[model samples]
Target: MSAVTDRTEAGAGAAATAGAPVMTRRLRVILLLLLGAQFMLAADFSILNVALPDIGKGLGFSLGNLQWVTTAFSLAAAGFTLLFGRVADLFGRRRLFLIGMALLTAASLVGGVAESPGILLAGRVAQGLATAMVTPAALSLLTTSFPEGPLRDRALGLNGAMLSAGFITGAVLGGVLTDLLSWRWAFFINLPVGVTVLVLAMTVLKESRAERTAKLDVPGAVTVSAGLLALVYGITAAQSDGWGSVGTLLPLLLGIALLVAFYVIELRAAEPLASVRVLKRRTVRWGNLGGLITFTMGSGVTFLMTLYLQKVLGFSPLVTGLSFGLLGVAAFVGGALAPRLIGRFGGPKALVGGLLVQGAASFLLAGIGGGSKSWLILVLAGTAVSGFGHISAVVSYMVTGTSGLPDGEQGLATGLTTLTQLVGLTLGIPVLSSIVTARTTALQATHSAADSVLAGVRLALLVNGGVLLVGALAIALFFARGTARRSATA
Candidate 1:
């Protein structure tokens, strides 16, 4: 019996060796396919922002109602990300990815055909659910497929670049579509791309199952998703209704209570979706906190800048989207350059310094009042500075946060990182929007809509700059100085 067991184990080892090369080739194929899919998903989020006015006009939506077109996708994506990540671990990454792509494609079709705002929002909600599945699965695939070294770093850098590129491309593409075709085509455009990605994914991606099987934490998933959704919705609604409104207050309070309950549930669950023990690590803890704050500021800035350029500066949608190209370029370059910077400066220094620089850049822009200045050149300079700093800080956090984790835990780590950004951006929009809305109202009492919008934009940037300053302080206090040099080989 002992001899037979030994022989079986030997045969298994031999088979693994024989299959290794083929597996490597398959992983490369899978990486490219997932990258393409991720780019499409990321692009879709920002692409429609510039097209929002056209869409509202075409659909006959009120300005306040139109925000849901963006809000629905965000809330859904943010709420279900962790839940879907856990589900992927339980089922299979390849399986969930395929399912997500299909759903996204289907939702795009529905969105294109929708005749009313309600239907469009429904489609967006579906798209959001699909994104929740796709984003984390894509990251998990990358983490598992690439061996942990320079290869992985390059892959991640490219991934970050693609994410930025997608946002830029989406803006340009959405503008062209809205101008030439109808706003409906902004969504319809996803159909062909999604199909192409799905086909490639099926051919190239190999299935991966969890090494240590665990049951789904149903209560945890339910409570957390619900809490996040509630919080996001309440915040967004607060822009229209007063923050103290009972409608908003009830959900906000419930959300906090549920999130606290989720923590307690996690402690008792046999297999917690996200093990608190993992988060206890210094790198993971601080990285998540800093990421949340930075991303919140990023979204707030982007939204305000868009409003300023289009409504105040009177730029065309196409031109407005095109203007962002410079910032996008900076983000791409910054991500590509981050690993080198981290190797030289260490993690903590890069993070804190980057945040400080970004905050300073926003303050610089704020100093330039909303007057009739050389609007293009001034905006470009400010955006480029902030964009470079933002990407630098983000890439640093990504590298440091997931660096020391075991392979199996990489999914949760990535999920946590993404969750922070997702939640931050979703919540931050309303926070910044409220500031803009309130300030716009006050400014309008004394000025025209154009001037009022510009004033609100300036105010939002100032507030966001202050928030980033706080983040910089947090980074310096928590992250060690040598993090920049830690990944020198990468």
Candidate 2:
């Protein structure tokens, strides 16, 4: 009997050892497909920037309405993300993901062949809506598939790297495609990639939904979606219309009112779209705040740097895009190392440290002067350093934000995190651009145009760095206190 038991145990051990590699391979495949979908969605946000002029010309878009091509996408994506995220949880994450991928592929085809501005705009809107469905669903799938530990950390790190790489790659590819082929290629390029991902996903991905589904929260969804749409529109419009203008204020106020109403509705709902209790968690709240700070300041500084490169140094669009290659490489490296850092220092500490590093890099960039090619070296160094820190912070915040939540709430948590990212990206450039414009206008009376522009860029960079520092300090203190309380209770 003893010999028989020994043999059974040995056989079980051998089988487990043999299956380890197979499990690892499967996880890798799943990660790749999930990241691929995320990368496509993220890249779409920036892919059309360089191709915009060509699109306007080809599609007969007026100067005033051309911005809508991008704005429409941003508005739909940011507005509907939270609603779709909850919907994905209640219904089916895998189903929504496939639907989104298919819609994105079809929308790309429509936009690629568009002969009128209206047709192109409709396609852009569809792409945005598809992205809203895809982003949270893919993230929720990743979080649910990987157990909470170092493995999950590594997956999220790769996700962060892919997101950064996608944005940078989009800019570069947009220029190359526009200059070499045509702007239509910008839309057409997603075809093969999307179709490939869709095929692989259907085979490799498993279906996942909340363990206990609840009824759809229609009122909560409507109010939040409408509010977000109005808010995003107002923020985007502020770039052209002054902040105080009726166009901006009316929507802004209406959005706020609707959002407040949504919250009130949520407090009474049987199953809230976003659980107030879950949102009150220390990690979720502070982590999201940290995400907002990093994305807003990082994107704002990047835009200012772009203007400095193109407007001040007179680099062409393609050259400017190429110059950002170093930043992308640094971000990739940073993301690769992020899981190790988090394992060593824990999420909160890593997040604070990343913010500090990013802030310091922004300060270094604030030293740029006017009319000197030498500043290019500083620009490259600053961008590279900031990119590293920015990706690290991004990964840390995501890990922190989604940690300590149940499988059921993963979709909602991911939605909130992604929403912050979208909001920050949408609002950062316009807000900072307004400040720079005001400052430049004021300085134009006494300074040369180049000097005034440089001054504005420098000032914006300072604000960017300052805000990062403040946010880091706040998060560090909050987390420190929470840690103390937990330790005491334990």
* lDDT scores in order: 0.80, 0.91
TM-scores, all candidates, are 0.89, 0.95
Considering only N, C-alpha and C atoms within 3 Å, which residue pairs clash in candidate 1?
Answer: 342-484, 346-483, 346-484, 346-485, 347-483, 347-484
Find the 10 residues in a row with the least total lDDT in model 2.
Answer: 16-25
lDDT of 2 at 339: 92
Model 1 ranges off by over 4 Å: 1-28, 371-373, 481-490
lDDT (C-alpha) at residue 433 in model 1: 85
Q: Please give the lDDT score for candidate 1.
A: 0.80
What's the lDDT for residue 91 in model 1?
85
- Summarize candidate 2's per-residue lDDT along 1-490 as a digit string, tens digits: 2677557646754665675312245677899999998888878988898888899899899888998999999999999999988988989999999999999999999999999998999999999999999999999999998878787899999999999999889988999999999999999999999999999999888889999969988899999999999999999999999799999999999999999999998999998998888778998999999999999888887789889998888888888888889999999998999999999999888999999999999999999986777888999999999999999999999999999999999999999999989988998898899889999999999998888999899988988899999999999998899889999999
Residues 440-466, candidate 1: write the lDDT tens digits: 899787899988877788888899899
